[model samples]
Target chain A: MTATVHRLRKAAPSLDPMLALVAGDMNAVNAVILDRMQSQIPLIPELAGHLIAGGGKRMRPMLTLASARLIGYTGTRHHRLAAAVEFIHTATLLHDDVVDGSDLRRGRRTANIIWGNPASVLVGDFLFSRSFELMVEDGSLKVLKILSNASAVIAEGEVNQLTAARRVDLGEDRYLDIIGAKTAALFAAACRIAAVVAERPEAEETALDAYGRNLGIAFQLVDDAIDYVSDAGTMGKDAGDDFREGKMTLPVILAHARGTPEERQFWKDAVEGRRDSDADFAHAVELVQRSRAVDDTLARARHYGQRAIDAIAGFPDGAAKAAMVEAVEFAVARAY
Target chain B: MTATVHRLRKAAPSLDPMLALVAGDMNAVNAVILDRMQSQIPLIPELAGHLIAGGGKRMRPMLTLASARLIGYTGTRHHRLAAAVEFIHTATLLHDDVVDGSDLRRGRRTANIIWGNPASVLVGDFLFSRSFELMVEDGSLKVLKILSNASAVIAEGEVNQLTAARRVDLGEDRYLDIIGAKTAALFAAACRIAAVVAERPEAEETALDAYGRNLGIAFQLVDDAIDYVSDAGTMGKDAGDDFREGKMTLPVILAHARGTPEERQFWKDAVEGRRDSDADFAHAVELVQRSRAVDDTLARARHYGQRAIDAIAGFPDGAAKAAMVEAVEFAVARAY
Candidate 1:
């Protein structure tokens, strides 16, 4: 493992009991997950397998499994829910590539680029249906309700982002709402739903939901910040890629909000007018840094991360709780 | 009213009960639907409105309300579900216009032609999200489960249709499966879910579901046949529109399956490739008639219609039951 991987692992709590639970005593849950994730069409399986194997951190699915384990779930529904979460994430990624018109994702050609937009779209639908089919096997109405609402929120967030693209008038609250809808809602749903499926007490369910929501918010904010400041090679794309694509990320919006008339004019002409060249992109990056937008963005992410940790404070200091806390800290501290 | 309208009124039963149920006694449902369906953006709302108001007979939403009532539902959730069904159908129409590159729908310009593809696609997403938001208001896990599955199936069916387009090997079973997934699944869900939410007995629910499935199959078959035989004004838009677009409707597929070598070659060239003028279209229409393909197609539709009526056989004979039977008969008998 790389140093980053080593660091993340060291920080992770050793929840042996939870791990044992997920291992299904004979690794049956893992087998079920693997068997169910396969697509009927070889190409869909291949494309999805590539993404699943591409080191996604597996934060959402892990939460689902961990939440179920923490709540003392005995049946195999958690396994199905975990697999459902992963499928939902993968489906969103397929659609996201089309919406972003992206070529590379995680240092590889996007599925849209490799398999064509129609294939990506159709396969994405297949995954979505496959998810419902899996969840139905679990026969848990709570899981269905949570996941369905999450999908709708995610789609709405995408639409809102599309409408907000290239517009510099986006404020901090709007950014929060957009990202919350797009990213955090599903993350929260993933963990919250695991608890719901396990039939946990209402208080524990509420605490876990708050923790997941805050953690997800922090994760997205950090991602936005990294998009403006991370190394192109390490990040698998250019820094300020969002700005180049005319996305009004938090840093750019903040920087523009605080810019002088001349600076604002430059942005109006460049960002909104499709000025996606190296020079224009570099200028935008410089402006964001000069304005200290990166610092403010990081601070906001840290605030959310702290709140994430705070959310789990009501629980006993067990290994699962500690691991959840550490995950939030690592999310805020990590570099791309 | 015209003779056709008068006949339709006689055949359509008293839709007032279903309409009133969908609109609710308070009348807020219609206002909400009108408000949500109205577009503030330029040209999009106009085109969408034109199609939305195109005297569509509101068949899908009516099915939802009628099924819910048949199951003894007393809640307002059915109204919201009805609205959601309409939104989904409208969204599909928007996407279908782009995929078919259609200029007119129900004798009016399609949304794609009026608002461009990008706008139509994005707004289609909007309507999709709106549908989910509407469904979410009911907070019924059963309803969410049914709708989510239906949405996924619809997307899959669209993808399958896209793949099957421009191919001559598209057989009858594949065609039926495609239409079943794309169109009938939602209708089936609309009817069955009402029974589900009302907590009816499984047998009754299954019956309503079968009624919807058979009705949808019959509805699509007759609609496809009318593309060849009906007047442009009566059917809305010009006749032979599907042929001009190279769509392989039931009549064409039937004719091709039973044709001689010369007729088969003509089918392959005209339906699969080599775009032709008005003369070629005329010749193709003549061939379809000479082969008696339309008769076979209508017979198949009637078979499904009979099954639809048979599905509701156990229900105590009442106006609603009679109306459903008459509706099926009218749907199949219209073109003839």
Candidate 2:
């Protein structure tokens, strides 16, 4: 009679190799980020720094740098573009905190919570404008096109999510579209610009884009799944936070789809903001587990992760590719 | 007994001539605006149209078009750039409404009021991103640099104003800086981009830029002055709205500076949110009038208006020049 250990991940899939692959490049991005975020208006840097200095994994920029390595490109043009990508991501996060009224991010108080919504909104605008300036400085019309279009898509997706909020009938298809625009658009743009800066062929750009887009979707789904995992080990995300906020994510969608009539009513009530207490959340975890919603969510993640790895399969099989593959695995396995 | 009209303007000083000058070009610009404001998300157009079609003067875009005419630019490139300028202006207005928590704009319910702040914010971001898409489409790095830097300056100005809010000690110099960034930066960029598209000389570009910058500062000063006028005819700006919101404008700065000790205390109380009743507002107006703060503010606007006219004096004396000069006079005289 021995206790069983249920580990969902294979060995220790980690971002360590990817971090090692681009550690020096990330430092350059950090410097660009710091230099560009500054303003004579003190509040700009103060509010922007709160989130930039907070513990984001720099995944989007890291993708840019690693993709460059995959192409065997030795140019430094990718550095500015990577910083621009990070700035775009940071702008989105700042606005998201305000739109979500979120108080905590990466285990610290959100900029909106600390600096107020107006400051957050204005600083986000500054960073966004600064991103375009950086792109223009890079002097690549193709890169500008990719990023400017991506920015518009991300904003459209944000509005899509806002309208879909608190709705019990948001199907998986629309949910996919929403996340595709809001989350994956930037990811794709970040990777695609690396190919553009490297002067690679259109095929390479499209391939890297596919890689980032698929990984972004998988990463977001696992993040959604982690919200219901009672023993979640993630640093900033507390379990049941989304449940309390009536956030519409895939696990809830799947659980509601497979639920009994009474359980369905429970989910509807919870989503509509009636049932949000600890007992209700506990019951929610139980329901999702019994229905295997979280498990299936992670399973879905792995499917996309495979697609992500395959997207870049044509590139050389070395440290860059291996680290990228492991990073995708790490994204999907974080829920464990 | 004959009535003393006491009109501040010398002649009619209407914008009709400028309107007539750019009527054809503006139609092209309006088409671009309507076409580009659209998105698959119906809400984007709906929310944006509430302001875009809701009776804005389209002053910024008109500057672009009219500047092109002044520079003898025959290409249609300025049309897209003009629409882009309007998009940036519209985006800023939408966010401004949200930041101010404004309920009404141009006498109609604000988008933020009707669609919610979240919609307004996201739509503003969408339009901002869309503006960049237009710039990228135009494929002018020079124009992109000018507009993007203007955007950053505008955001910085907004944050500066936020930090300066409710401070009676906000001096006239800082007030100029705030309005310069928030209002004049875009005007200068809008005018300068016309020169870029026209491939004009740097001297001509600088001339157009100075003209627009001076006019913008004058235009904003008049707008600020209108808020204190007992009979402000500007449809959108309500008298005492700024006073109630503790907004730090030149009128308050001057009125505070020249006040008696007791009057200074009154202003401090008003700016600090202690005095905001209807009667209190009436008293505040009286204090500013007695100090001649409103009159002095208009005088300052006239000085800038004169400079605006003089900056473009070097341009050929033609219909464009006359219209532009009249436009400046019209702006400075609007409070009448």
In terms of lDDT, the best-performing candidate is 2
Cα lDDT over the full model 2: 0.91
Which parts of model 2 have CA positions greater than 4 angstroms off? Answer: A1-9, B1-9
List-wise, what DockQ does each model earn? 0.26, 0.78
The window of 10 residues in a row where model 1 chain B has the poorest summed lDDT is: B1-10
- Report the lDDT tens digits of candidate 2 across residue range B227-300: 89988866477898889988989999999999999999999999899999999999989988999999999999
Chain A TM-score by candidate, in order: 0.88, 0.96
Q: List the residue pairs that clash in candidate 1.
A: none
**For candidate 1, what is the lDDT?**
0.71
Name model 1 segments beyond 4 Å from true.
Answer: A1-55, A69-75, A133-141, A233-235, B1-55, B68-77, B94-104, B108-149, B197-199, B234-237, B260-262
TM-score, cand. 1:
0.83
Best by TM-score: 2
lDDT of 2 by residue, A1-336 (tens): 442222234877998999999999889889999999999999998889888888888989999999999998898899999989999899999888888899988879999889899988999999999999999999998999999999999999999999899998898999999999999999898888888988899999999999999999999999999999988756478999999999999999999999999999998999999999999999999999999999998898888888888888778778998888889989988888
Error of 1 at A301 (Å): 1.7
